[model samples]
Target: MENKKANKLIDKILENLDKTGINTETLIDDIKELRTYALEEQIPLVVKVLRYTYEHIEENNSFLIPTLDDEPLDEEGDVIEEEADSPVESLKYLLSLIKNLKNKVNISDLKEYRDLLKAY
Candidate 1:
C-alpha cells in the first residue's frame, strides 16, 4: 500500500535539513525497527516522546534526556550522551534524531507511525 503520510514526513524532515549542511544520508541508516516500536506503542514515536517530556517537566523540573544507547555510535563514532546541559541542547539532539530517522526504511514499514502522526 502507498503510504503518503510517511513520504510527507520524510519530505518535511528533508526540507528542514535542506540548508543545515547536516549529513542526512548518514543520519538515516537502519530504521526498520523504529516502525515496529511505533506500531507496538500505537503512537507517533516523536509525539509520544515529546509529550512525555512535557509532562515530565510540568511534574518535575528535572529530566534525564532519553537515550538511544542501544543504537550504534554516530557517524563520528562519538558517544551521544543521555543527558544535555540545557533544554536547547536537548532539543537539538532530539531534532537530530528525527532527521536521522528519514532514511533506509520503506514507507510501508513506516505506515503506522505516519498514521499516528496524522491522527495526532
Candidate 2:
C-alpha cells in the first residue's frame, strides 16, 4: 500500500519537474532551508514548511542547510576535527550544528574546530 503511494508521489514529483523546467540543482537549493529546525512535536509546522518552501521555493532561493559530519573518531573514541574551507564560516557552521546535536550525543571535536584552529 505504501509503495503504491510512494510511487505515486515520486511520479507526481517527476511530472512536476518535467512540466516546470526545474533541475536537480534547483530542487536542492530550494529544499535546503529546511535542513535546519530540529524535529519537534510540531508535525503540522514541518509539513507546512515543506509545502510552503517546495511550492514557493524559487522566491526564497537561498539558505543552505548547515549540516555537517561527525568528526573522525579513533579507537579510543577521541574526536579528530579536520580543517574545513573558510575557517570562520566553518566554525560558525559547526557551532550551530553543535548547538543542535549537543543534547543528542557527545560531538567531541565540535565538528573539527580544533583541527581548523591548528591549520589557522
Candidate 3:
C-alpha cells in the first residue's frame, strides 16, 4: 500500500541520520534541502515524510509550511509583506549593502571580496 511505502521511506531516512552525528542545526538544514530535492524529483512519499519530520520533530515551534502571520515589517513597523519582491531591487539592495560594508572595512582585495560574498 502507499502508506507502507511512505513508512519505509521515513524509516530509511531515520536510519541514515542515525549513522552520523550531525549537529541539530546542520541536520535541520540538510532535511530542508532534502525536502526541496524530493519535491523537485517528484517523490511523493519522500515529501510526506519530510513534512511529518518538520511538523513533529523539528524545534521550529511551527510546521514547515508558512503561516499567514509570517510577514515583513515596513518603516512604520507595519507588515505590508507582499508575496514576492522584485529580483532587480533585491540584487541592487544587496550590492549596495556589500559596497557600503567594503568601504567601511577598506577591503579591496579579491580574498576579502570573496570572504564578504560568502558571509552574506
Instruction: Specify the highest-lDDT model's number.
Output: 3
- Model 2's alpha-carbon lDDT is 0.39
Clashes of each: 0, 1, 0
lDDT of 3: 0.41
Q: Write candidate 1's Cα lDDT for 1-120 as tens digits.
A: 123444354454445445442333432321233333444545465545445443443444433343222444778998665533453343344444543445534233234333433343
Q: List the candidates' TM-scores in order.
A: 0.31, 0.28, 0.31
How does model 1 score by TM-score?
0.31
Residue range 34-72, candidate 3, lDDT tens digits: 566557767554455445544343554322222112377
Candidate 1 has an lDDT of 0.40
- Residue 35, model 3: Cα distance from true site in angstroms: 0.9
Worst-scoring 10-residue span by lDDT in model 3: 90-99
Candidate 1 all-Cα RMSD: 12.0
